[model samples]
Target: MPAKPRILFCHCNYARVVPDEVKSSVLEGLCKSGQAFDAVADLCEMAARRDPALKRLAAGESPVKIAACYPRAVKWLFGGCQAPLNAEHTEVVNMRELNAEDATNTVLNKTLTPNLPADGSVAKVEGEKKI
Candidate 1:
């Protein structure tokens, strides 16, 4: 079986949009699932400075799900990485608006499920109501 995709969470250290407690709660839930993930202080800054972690992420062939701010910002942040980031292989969840539980559920559903479409976009699961 193929490995599950990586889940990256940005705490938005600089912007301070999502509450720390909320971010921590979501991170705890995700960690408990035994999935591969990284909860970083600031992915935007890391990507801006060409952090090695970004390079590593770019090199991998696995799909990536990012729990962060706006999708546009996430895309712009990682745009200049050495290894090109393919839009089809990436998904970004807007953490700014969601509560801890909803954010956690979103990440879990997006990363753990095997039913994603060819474009790597998440399809709504049957009977699953959006928070």
Candidate 2:
């Protein structure tokens, strides 16, 4: 069986783009679920400084679910730091588009449906992997 995907939460503190209610509720749900997660104050700031953490986060071949604004933006941010995500193993939950509960559920779910855009422009929400 595939290992449970790790959760990565972004506070979006730099631009305040993610909705306040959604961010709080998601964080609450993550805490309540008791799942291990990495919560960063802001991904944009990390990308700007090329923080080593980004490289670490993108290191493992295991799947990762990132609770952030947009898939494309998340892809861009990581790529900028020379820590490009594994598009096939990365699932980006757009807190900007999804409600708090939905976002939380998506992140906490064991099933990983990779959401990174294939073309690098559009955001792909639906599961792209086919059996």
Candidate 3:
């Protein structure tokens, strides 16, 4: 059997980007399911601090599922910290867009779907501008 993708949960503690109920629900589900997972208070803070955990998480060959705000944002955040995730082996469940149940279900699901957008997902291009 293929190895199960590692689960990474972002609490988004500093910013209120992710709804309180959604984060709470997803966390509850994860705890109830008894599946081992890594939870961080905030991804943005981790990136700002250049946390080594990000590198550790991105170092392995196994796929990873990250429950966070936006796929694009998460992608860039990881890249900014020099721990860029594999675009083909990472999945970000957008808690901002997905309800608690949907986010929780997707994270728990065994199917691995690489949802991280391609390069420039964060407007890194020379001409790209944030509107």
lDDT of 1 by residue, 30-121 (tens): 87988777778888788666676876765567877778877766665665444345666677777787887887788887554322223333
Better structure of 1 and 3 per lDDT: 3
C-alpha TM-scores of all predictions? 0.71, 0.88, 0.88
**Local distance difference test, candidate 2:** 0.86
Lowest-sum lDDT 10-residue window in model 3: 122-131
Which regions of candidate 1 fall more than 4 Å away from where they truly are? 1-3, 110-131
- On residues 12-39, what C-alpha lDDT tens digit does candidate 3 reach at each position? 9987878999999999999999899999
Q: Return the lDDT, model 2, position 22.
A: 95
TM-score of 3: 0.88
What is each predicted model's overall lDDT from 0 to 1?
Answer: 0.69, 0.86, 0.86
- Estimate the lDDT of model 3: 0.86
Q: Look at candidate 3 and give me any clashing residue pairs.
A: none
Q: Write the per-residue lDDT of candidate 2 for residues 25-99, one digit (tens) a residue.
A: 999999999889999999988877768899898889899999998898899888766678999999999999999
RMSD of each: 11.0, 8.5, 4.9
Q: Model 2 misses residue 17 by how many Å? A: 1.8
